[model samples]
Target: MADAPRSTPGREITTGERRRKAWANWSGAVRGIADSLLSPATTDELREIVLDDAARARGIGVVGSGHSYADLVAPAGRTLLDLRHHRGIDTVDPAAMTVTVRAGTTMRELNQELAAAGYALPNQSAIDEQTVAGVVATATHGSSPGLGTLSSHVVAARVLTADGRVRTVTRDDPELDGVRVHLGCLGVVLDLTFTVVPGHRLRKVVHRKPLPEVLADLGAFRDVHFGGFWWYPHTSQAIVWEASPTDEPPTPPPARPGALLSLLCNNSWTPRIAGAAHYAAAVAAGRGGARVLRRDDALLHHLPPPVQGTEYSVPFDRAADAIRALVGEVRRGGLRVSAPVDVRFTAADTGWLSPSRQSPTCHIGVTHPVSAHDPQGWIAPLRAADSVLWEFDGRPHWAKVHFRTGRELASRYPEWDRFQELRRTWDPDGVFLGAHLRRLFEH
Candidate 1:
């Protein structure tokens, strides 16, 4: 018989011993119990666990920063490979403008290290707390017609396959395209190498305008290096954000009132208070202001309150039409959304599973704070938006909430078959398959 699984380094539990604990994603949207949790500090230790027959007999899944609101990290009676302990800058090649880091390193840590070395990532998502591997796995992105998703920056990666072997993949490797956005199905990513650029500064300008005005001039938004906007539901006003490179000294970001307002909006004391808060916030932001900051600072925005939502990517040309239809549906349904609808853009990328694959895309996100009184009220609006986006051939973001199954998702991704082939080659025994992935791939 195979040896029993080990929960920690240098220690193994008895065959009769089994430990289980409840796990939930960041927003508390998805929760389940994990049979066992393993945090391996080194590649050798990770391989040892992967190779264990007893552990492989059960299921194994990897969990990163747990930022995803979806069930991507939901483990049910399976071992979860937590990579938090395996984090750091492994190597830096300044001449080649590349940095290799352990998969668990957070974007904030990586960006700070790169800044100290006079380098930075070409693009960044709003939140910096996600692990490097997690970001790339989900194809996390930012608003910029010139920059692709984070996965696009990965030139190479070292992944520990289900059979206990490390596979080093480079940009030239055809398999690399699928591995870049593996969705935790391919294998456990050990480390990643990303191409970087010289550190720079950005000037961010925020102003409010009628939604129609901005939508009419979508071309103007795309012309900037980075641009996006926030649309407050039940109102015609929207806050527009545009950024461009600048050499001027950095300025502090304006004080944000979102925190206090979000608290009042989500509080159980009065449900209608949330809608009022959003309106007030939108009105206040309509006033124009500008801030000059380091590229990292400008790219990383404040974390919103605990919320659950979905994001969908549509072709750039159909973005305005989709948004209009979504807004109209929300109004017709009379759904009360407590947060702004976020709109952003990303350049086309080659990642086989990326939402922006093959064409420039616009990402529209709708979020609502968890309500104590009417928790299920937000679902109608999200479903409504999902229907509108789907009509336009929208693809859902991997890390966000969505109800797409393998059959539906396969039709959206042209390289779905190729990704599945690579996944089988790396994890033939389904070692890394989780409940969510099973619904997405095996269904």
Candidate 2:
């Protein structure tokens, strides 16, 4: 039976295993102190564990390669079901351009398989270590000229509800829209079937330009460019653009240059303990290179170990004004700018809740270096700018940090009630609801 029938003693796990259970992209702040981390490879087994724990009063939380922040997995004390072992591409329909995959499959693995078949996901969020389920559940996105978030590609999915029932749904199905960005509230999404596009080669062109001139030509540049951006907290400069052709090419060998940089920058102790030794090493490698070029799958994403990120999007027209204001506040506040604020453009999508729902938008992403540094004071200047963004009809990124609450959230998303109706039907018991979710949806 998928649902377990008996109570069993909690499994024992070694400390070495516990250390391995931590997040790959997020900080260790939210890690839970769990007695054991069990990884099941199949749907039936996952169901059995959930049912067994529910019957035994052992709190169980599902984890997908640990890509997100917040205490969703910080069990305080409970059982954790890490889904890494259950990772795989379950099915693919070349004719239909769609694929079905296990929830735990990493984006990196998915792209590799898709490339071999001459296909790839239409859009990908910046980081690639996140599980397919984790990315879709959080409504991850990329800077697509026309499409919406990653959830928009989800045609169907199988979610393990709080009661241990596996419900299969599709975009054409009534409950589809709500569950795609469900925050695991509908339950553990065991598998997802989504659309894929033909693989393509990206031509990267990096040039520094002034923000004002770029904004004046935003529409002209976006017409031909697949991805366009302006870098910040280093606002005096902008990363002009990149264009990629949609065609199949010989697969490239695996590369780790970007991965190594991520490791060095994200280590809290290495910078704190090693100090100038680490900085000296980075300098010795030569910091003069800025042209980031890779294949379609590789160019758009990064694999930084978890650091905090806060992103917000306002109307396209208001983008330049908002950025100038935000930067001004940061400077006036005397805040140290470490990571460059990322600015990207995306056209409106069909998804009702995507940040770019009805109009073209400019996304301003604020990232903090996870390396040891004083960042507590940095949040305040961001908070000040957040106030102005909220006034300009800005919507915060779901996966990133923000100070907005559920009450304000409802005002921004017109489809809020319908989403709530669907959430109520699938998760009537609210078993998957957490503090982060409550603040975002269920006030």
Per-model TM against the reference: 0.93, 0.82
Query: What CA root-mean-square deviation does each model show from the true structure?
Result: 3.3, 5.4
Residue by residue across 240-294, what tens digits does model 2's lDDT show?
Answer: 6555663344344334546545544333332233333334324422332334333
The regions of model 1 sitting more than 4 angstroms off are: 1-20, 256-258, 264-276, 372-377
Range of the 10 consecutive residues with the lowest summed lDDT in candidate 1: 6-15
lDDT of 1: 0.82
Segments of candidate 2 deviating more than 4 angstroms: 1-25, 34-36, 53-59, 72-74, 246-295, 301-306, 334-336, 371-378
Instruction: Give the clashing residue pairs of candidate 1, or none.
Output: 265-274
